[model samples]
Structure formats: C-alpha cells, structure tokens
Target chain A: MSLSSTNSFEKSPVEKSDKGTPDHGECLKVLSLVLDQEATDEEQAYFKQHIENCMPYYEIYNVDKAIKSMIKDRCLNQKTPSDLVESIKSKIYQQAD
Target chain B: MSDNKRQSYSQREKEKTFEQEFLPHIDSMYNFAYRLTFDEDDAKDLVQDTYLKAYRFIESFEKGTNAKAWLFRILKNSFINDFRKKSKQPAKVDYQEVETFYNSEDVDKSITTDLRIETVQDMIGDEISNALNSLDVDFRTVIILCDLEGFKYDEMAKILDIPIGTVRSRLHRARNLLKERLKEYAQKMGYKN
Candidate 1:
C-alpha cells in the first residue's frame, strides 16, 4: 500500500445495501452534528443507535472526535503575546482620558 | 451598528463592561486574530483594532449578553475588511466560488483518504497546526470557532452573518477538509493501513 494512497473509508455502509439504514453520508452528518452538540434529541438518539449497530459509523465517530480534540489541544497552545493585553488596556485608558 | 435599539452605558459602566465582560476574552480574540492573519504583528494589530471597535460600539452591546460572540463578530468583520483586503495571502478565492466548489458532489469522492485514528493521535507536534493553517481561511475560521472556541451553531450563525443551516453545512465541510489535510500529514509521517 502506497503511503500517498487515498481511498474511501473502509467498509463504508454506503457501499452496502442495508435496507432501512442510513447511508454513510447521512451517518457522517448525524455524527458531526451530535459531536458538535448541534443535533436534536432525535438526531442524537439516531446516532447513538446507528453507531452501536454500524461498525464503520463507530470507527468514523472515534476518528472524527479525535481530530476535533487534537485541533483544540494543538491550537490552544499559542499563548497571546504578553504585552498585547497591556497595550490594549493602555489604549482604552488613553482613549477614555 | 446604527440600529436604534443600542444600549446606553455611562462611561463608568462602559469601562466596567469592557473590563468584566470583554477583556476576559482577550486571549481568545488574540488567538482568533493570529489564526486568521497567520502573522504575529498582524494578529496584534487586528486584536487591537477589534478591541477599539468593540469599545467604540460599546453602546450597542447589551450589558449581560454573549460578549465573546459579539467581540468575535467584530473581529471577523475587521479581519475581512482590513487584513484580508491588503494581505498578500495566496489562494484568495472568492467565498462564493469556494462554497460552490465545496458543495459539489465530487469533493467527497476525491478526498477519501483513509486516515487512521492512531495516526491522528500520533501527531503531537506542529502537524495538526500546519494542517489547520493549510486550510482555506473560511474553513479554518469555522474550525477555530466551533472546535476551539466552542461556539454553538446559532452563535456561529450570528457571528458569521450566515443562516444557521449554512453554518452547519460549512462547519461540516470544514471538518472534512481538515480530515483530508490530516490524512496528508499522516501519509507524510509514513502512516499506512
């Protein structure tokens, strides 16, 4: 397998004909909404149940959640410059004076 | 800003609100600016300008409302009008064009990189940061607002001046794009399934 190789998510439910089940795209959308806390109660319930039964959805959910946390953790490290705060405060004071 | 429903604040109350409400979000504002401009000096100036505008428009701000979201809206507007206009950043595609392209069906098929969770967890360095920075500014903004700042969908819609549906769709697209970027980095690090 080439390192640069790219392929669709393995074992995608979209590739199969699981009757009455949501496809990969719908599952991904619900998963995103649920993780972001934007999902309604029904969507959340749907995701919970879907992930339990669908292995691909479960895997995708874990990976998606991990990526979001990693972004939050990595991006939070860049401390704002120390002087910037003082500078802003001083400017506000000067403007008021 | 010219709406007639602006709040009236005494000078003391204005300062109080600024200190108690707005100033607490300085780090977040600075981080947002830094992410947008991707330059330290530009980020400082942008943050300062945003604060200045926020203070000037302090009368429009309710005393006990979502101060962070209000400040973010101001900062985003300032970045668009001031920084994005003059900055020599590459790939300055029109927002409409970018949105249309992202909305296309082909994008999903084209970026089906099988990035593993372990490989993503292994990126402890600047890999994640670089991947984030590589995204289009619009996409980067959504991730920072949603993932980093923890803004809700409605709040994000207000800050971005878009419908809530747009915010949700854009954020969804942004995350997928971000995953694609991370997949590229994983490949670089010799991750294979």
Candidate 2:
C-alpha cells in the first residue's frame, strides 16, 4: 500500500467551537505579515513566541515555505560548481577525516 | 583597514573581497533564479548574470542595506528583463480559479475547522516547486521570499521594491494558490480525502 494514495487522505472533521476564530484569523494575518517583515518587532517577537508554542502559527511558516520553494529549488539545484566548490568540499572533508 | 579606504573600495577591489561573501550566496541566488525562471539552464545564467551585475554595481549598494535583498532585486530584474520577454503564452490568471474547484473543506455544518496541515507539509519538493512555477510572477515572488528564503515581510518589501500592502495582498493570494496546488498534488500523489 502506497502512502501517497489520495484515498488514504482524510479531510479531518472540523472540531466544533462555541467561539469563532476571528482573533485566530487575525493572528494568522499578523504572523503572515511577520514572515514578510511587515509586523513590528514587538509583534514579531510576540508571534515568534506564539508560533513556537502554537500549531496554527507554525502552519503560517509552512505556507511561507511553499511560497519560497520557487527560489529554494532554483538556488539549491543549479549548475554544478566549477571544480571550485568541489575542491573546497573535498578539502574540508579531508581535514575533517 | 581604515574608514576612508573602506568607503572608497573600487569596484574591482570590492569584487575581490565580496566574492567570498558573494560566492557563499551563489547557490541560493541560483536556486532563486531557477524557481523564478522554471528552467535550470536559465537559472544558472541568471545567477551568473546577477553576480556579475552585483559585482559591477556593489558601490551603489547602501552600506547598511541588505545585500541579499539587493542581489535578489538584481536577480529578479534580470529574470523579468531577460526571460519574461522571450516567453509567449496565455498568462493572466486568477489563481482563485483553482481554489474554487477543489472545495474539499470538511466542516460538519457545526464544529471547529481543522485545516489539513501535514500532508501539504510532506509533499515532494519538486512537485511543490512546479506548483510555484505555475503561479504568476507577482504572487510567486512573495512566496519565494517569505517561504523558502525566510525573508521577513518588511525585508521582502525592500527587496521587491513594492509597498508592504502589495506584499501582503500578493502573499495572501499566493498562499491560496499554493494550497490549491498542493491539494492537487496530494490527489495525484494518492492521498485519499
């Protein structure tokens, strides 16, 4: 059985809440803004702490990651370095060994 | 070693010294260019061009400003000027088109809403990369900066040469787009809903 099967995926049931997440949604926007540097340092620190403690806040960072994939794939996966990077890498490994 | 000399480093000297700084950032810049162009070959060229241009214009960089942002601006401009003009395709898209069709939000008409978080997190990087390539450049740039590079929003605005408001809106739109792509990728990857 392959884990990637679409059928294996389940849309987890929404757990009922008496209160709406207007503030949570607002917090999401705040964190989102933080990822872009729009939030104030105080707010940044606040959200940074919140994300460390909260799952939803971490979700914001993942979304940010999905967006950043563009540059990462490009920057990380380009042409092989001219013997330069390889030589340096070998030297470092040799020294380490 | 002194103030005046530091202030007056010629472009060639700047390059000689900054190459150490610049070399370390090359792969990141190349990856950025690759994602922006969606072509590995073009990505390499773009990165090379960005470094060359940055070397020539290092003097113009304000001493205290973000060098990464400066390089990104150069890479982005190079992408827009070099590649975007050469491609011919049907381009303007409302990314919401994809979002609306995949309406798999599971709410029982009552309780709390739980966003499916992990599978998206676990999706393959290449497929994820392709999804990013699908977005229009405007939305794509913000995602690239914030998500992959870990750039802050204000720093992103500074790098992108756009207002923070524009950055916010594009990021909002871009995330919605990525969610849509990931959902589809999930479907293909065989994740059952």
Residue-by-residue lDDT tens digits, candidate 1, B124-150: 759889888888998789899999999
Model 2 DockQ class: incorrect
Please give, as one word, the docking class of candidate 1: acceptable
TM-score of each: 0.85, 0.64
Error of 2 at B124 (Å): 2.9
Q: For residues A1-85, write the lDDT of model 2, one tens digit per residue.
A: 1121222112111221124332343345455556555666766665665567666557656655544554455435555456544
Off by over 4 Å in 1: A1-19, B88-113
Give the poorly placed runs of model 2, Cα more than 4 Å off. A1-25, A34-75, A83-97, B1-7, B88-115
